[model samples]
Target: MEFYLKENGVRTQLEYGELDISGNEDYGYRPFQLMIASIAGCSASVFRKILTKKKIEIEDLHITAEAERDAEHANKITKISLHFIVKGENLDKGKLEKSLELAKKNCTMVQSVKGSIEVVETLELINLSN
Candidate 1:
């Protein structure tokens, strides 16, 4: 919430890190990018907590986010799709799906924009324990 107008440009740093909002996409972090990052980061944490609490041992977890913007409506994000790749041992598809659902509900960023943006989540569980 707090910003510092440094020599380069305006920047904000908090729980995540320092972000430059100089309006130069190449040199600074765009507001839209930060929004998506918040969603992805919150979802990842919540999802991990849900799965771990269920006794699932995770080897790796990766989240990919893609968004569609409405060009006719001031380039606002219309839809966002999240793809999760979870590598783990004895992973149950049903449990993973349920965990993802819980994560989407509990994630603050996702909850904040749930009514405005269409969010889709897909979980790809890779079971290494065979």
Candidate 2:
């Protein structure tokens, strides 16, 4: 795989496996998708780590994310939201919120989008697995 980026540019071009993929694609996930994924992935990892550290037993975890794109020219993402649903035992809502806060604070990707994007998050607890 070869990746190229123009000097002082935000966009990058990537080539891999007989495919030409740019920062944004026509059919596959766009650049914004990758950005959101990084945020969600970072937060999810922090959440899991915090839960494990607190000795909270987790049976499953999932995150659903959505973003609103600007309709005008130079289309870009304006807002993003993520719903974090965790199935675990003896979960504490306060702790979960705190963990999320710390996740956003520590996540380089989340901080990278600061002021450029708006992010909202929700936490949900699910019944323990059978």
Candidate 3:
């Protein structure tokens, strides 16, 4: 991917559209935000695949990511916490926990930053059948 330098940030043309990346949020997406998104997106996708393979029916899946950045060290991301809110009918917590473990093991983004960044995953299940 090639990026062109813009007045405030850099812009890259992707298949979907143009991507703008900058340190300033006013201009474009911040690097850290993209990183967190990548991690969370990867994890959620993998988890959903696992659930589907297990024949688990779900109504909705949502993920929230929180990151811890160190100000003294170039504001690098030190840790990331991912919270998954799963809404479904008669969902099994045990199966969801196991699926999450598989997701963390298989997710490319999570594995890529394994040694460097601490990743924490948590889950909340809402059963519509209740």
- Model 3 per-residue lDDT at 66: 93
Candidate 3 matches the true fold with a TM-score of 0.98
Clashes of 1: 0
Clashes of each: 0, 0, 0
Model 3 regions more than 4 Å off: none
Candidate 2: give the clashing pairs.
none
Instruction: Give the winner by lDDT.
Output: 3
Per-residue lDDT tens digits for candidate 3, residues 85-107, read 99999999999999999999999
Taken over the whole model, the C-alpha lDDT of each candidate is 0.88, 0.76, 0.97
Better of 1 and 2 by lDDT: 1
Q: Rank the models by TM-score, top first.
A: 3, 1, 2
Per-residue CA lDDT of candidate 1, range 1-130, in tens?
9998866568888798777876568768777787888888999999998887988788999999999999999899988899999998888889889899999999998999988988899999889987
Top candidate when judged by TM-score against the true structure:
3
